[model samples]
Target: MRKSELDTPCILVDRVKLLDNIRRYQGYADAAGIALRPHAKTHKTPEIARLQVEAGAVGVTVAKLGEAEAMADGGIRDIVVAYPIVGSAKLARLIALARRAKITVACDGIDAAASLSEAALQSGLVIDVWVEVDPGYGRAGVLPGADLDRLASALVPLQGIRVCGALVFAGHSYGAETDAEREAIARNEAGTALLAAEALRGFGFPIESVSAGSTPVGRFASAMAGVTEIRPGTYVFGDVMMVKAAALAIEQCALTVLVTVVSRPAADRAVIDAGTKVFTMDGEDSAIGTGRGYVVGHPAIEVAWFNEEHGILKLPDGERGLRVGDRLEIVPAHCCAVVNMLDELHVLDGDRVGATWRIAARGKVK
Candidate 1:
């Protein structure tokens, strides 16, 4: 069926644009001599993960153990749980997941690594782990100086876990106001991880992989020497936030939410069927332009506010032709969060619905 004929507040992904995005980034990684490991947290669908793997991604990266499980069930053999997996309950699950695939987990401290080592020893399986280093994100990771030295020393005695290398996330690049600033952040991110890896190797640790990158800084981060792999998620489906960060052009946004104008309360006010539940509240703290979402082809229009089930739009002046039952496409502020709010994505074949892919890893927060 045609997109216009579909139900309101549904997702639409352009097939041609999607494939182009996959190939374009894969080509960049191949030329840079760095492995591309597309983070599955963006699409969270096994089918899209397979497409990335087929296009040249060495494996897929996930944010949680549940997402890793979904990918493994979908026949993906190599997976990376980029986040720390703590707690005994989760260790058991992580060990079980290792039996199904070559699982690589991350840790920033000796405690988590020791826990993983104990679990792997009990399961009689060696787990590959990348030490996550803080790249000024102020999130979860050890600093690149004496602290990192201490952690590396502490983890060296863990027999059940193998220290692969260091990893960094250039997430702070999202706050960059200019292209130069973003590139600088990317450089620092990769450099920090590489430095950590070098220190680990000097400490008699077998440092094999140095993974770093995010969608905003993936290109610059991958170009840096010593970065073995780059994990970018949002590059597969561009969004308004990415456009604002100068990482992607607005036209590269393949995924959009198709919503219908449910009511024209006033000449300047138009209400949509979708709300925060659909588009999410990701761009609230941004100093950049645009509101909750970017209205496709309607530059003057802004998503003024949203309730659970209602989206308020401020229309442009002059001939305001938007009426009830009018369908509008919105490029969400954040594609990853928006994808998690849906059950499936409607792939478009031109103007018709081509296929529907299940969001296999949505809500897999564990």
Candidate 2:
């Protein structure tokens, strides 16, 4: 098959570019002497996860138990659910997943840890856990200090829980305006997590791994001292936000939403069949650029807004090059959200269809 045969408003992944992304990040981690365990939440495709593993990813990181279940079912041997698992329903799945994969869960609070410990004990299996440390992002994870030690204390006494180490998500790096700023965020993330891990170790907890990752701060963050693993998901398919953040060149973007022009409403505006549903509204602060999404190679065009199924492309003054039936390639603001929105990615190697890989963990919000 070919690109022309695919339907509009679908994801197109350039296989060459995809493979390039995998190898590039893997090579970086190898050189940095850290394990590369890509976050599977970014792609959600087990096939792509296999490719990542083949490229030397030590394991896969997921944000939920459903995703871990899917990856483990797909034969990926190791995974880490990077989010706190709460409630009996989710814990049941988490414990089940632990039987199939080398599972590790992250949590910053003792309450969640208690639930996990109970579940692990009920399942009669030992569970490894990482004390999530907030690297000043203030989203999840305990701050690096006494708070982390408190959580570590709660887990250390649990018969079923093993304190592995610490994990930090350098999400704030996305807000950085320059490479130097990103590197600084990465360095801070590593240092912050290390401080908590060392503190935990002081209490006699075995701190075997110090995990960290963010696409914008990929190599810079992983190269930080004491970081044992790097989990990067967006690097599998670079997005417009990454390009705007100077994380990758526009040419390196492998995933794009292929949409067709449906209306040329006026000289200054046009409409495309894809909308927010196709290209989600996720942004990385300034990394989203000036438009809802960047029209690839069309700097003069801006997807100014999107309805449920209509994308309004605002054209530059006196520039109406697009016609009603023409197709456009859209670089989304967030590649991970785009993957979740689609059922399968139309794999392509420059205009020719390679194969379609189903998003194995789509809608696995649990």
Candidate 3:
């Protein structure tokens, strides 16, 4: 089967480009003397996760216990849940998972660590955990310098939880304008994380892994001497934001939504089958760019507006040649959410359908 034969509003991944991305990042991590643990939240497919492991990723990072279970069921032995697991239900599941694989979790506070430790002790298992250090994201982690020390100290001698090291998400470096700025941001974050790790060690805690990195920051994070692993997710499927950020070229984008022109309202306007439901309404807040997704192969065609099922395109004055039934590939503004919207992804290699991978853990938020 070919991509042209697939139904509209479907997710399509370019096999060759995806492999290139995986290999490129893996090579960078290998050369930098760091472990590559690509996040599974982006692709959420065991096949792709296995590809990363085969390409030299030490393991895969999952955001939830359900994702970890899916990967484990798919034969992935090493897993890391980068989010904090709090509730008893989820903690029990996490401990059970630890019995099967080398599973790890992240903690940024005392209560969460105590819960995890209690769960592990009840299950007769020891769970390795990373102390999350805030790297200016202000999302989940504890403040790096002193706050991190406090949390690490609180976890000491916990029955079944071992403080392995630190974890920082360099999300602030994503939209940086230049490579120098991005590198500087990653270096600063990595330095702070390393300092916190040393502080934990000084307090008699064993710090084994100092992890940091995102797709945009991976380029610079790989060069940071203290970072032991890079956890990049979007590199497996470059999106419009990555392209605009100059982190990836247009050809390197592995994921796109296949949409058909369903309405030609005017000479200079057309509507595509995909909209907020398929491409997602994210990454469009910048003052410097147009709205939502960008039409692939049509540089001048801008997705001016979108509803739940229809995307309005504003074609250039002389470029209004699109007709109903004509298909156009759209690179989503954010690929992660788009992947979650679908149940499966069509893998393609230069227009020829290669394979179909089930998105086994699309909406497993628990």
Tell me, by lDDT, which candidate is best.
1
Better of 1 and 2 by lDDT: 1
What shift in Å separates residue 361 of candidate 2 from its native position after superposition? 0.9
lDDT by residue (tens digit), candidate 2, 118-218: 88888899899888988888798897776776776666677789987799987878778888888888888888878887898888889899998778888
Tell me each candidate's RMSD, in Å, in order.
Answer: 1.5, 1.6, 1.5
Question: What lDDT score is found at residue 269 in candidate 3?
Answer: 89
Q: Estimate the TM-score of every prediction.
A: 0.97, 0.96, 0.96
lDDT of each: 0.87, 0.84, 0.85
lDDT of 3 by residue, 1-366 (tens): 988889978999988899999999888788889999999999889999999999899999999899999999888998989998989889878878888888989888899889888888888888898888888877889997677767766777687988887898868787688888888887888887888789888878788999888888777656688889989898899887787666788778899888899999998889988878887777743222545766677777777888899899888886788889999887788899898899999999788999999998798779
Worst 10 residues of 2 by lDDT: 281-290
Error of 1 at 357 (Å): 0.3
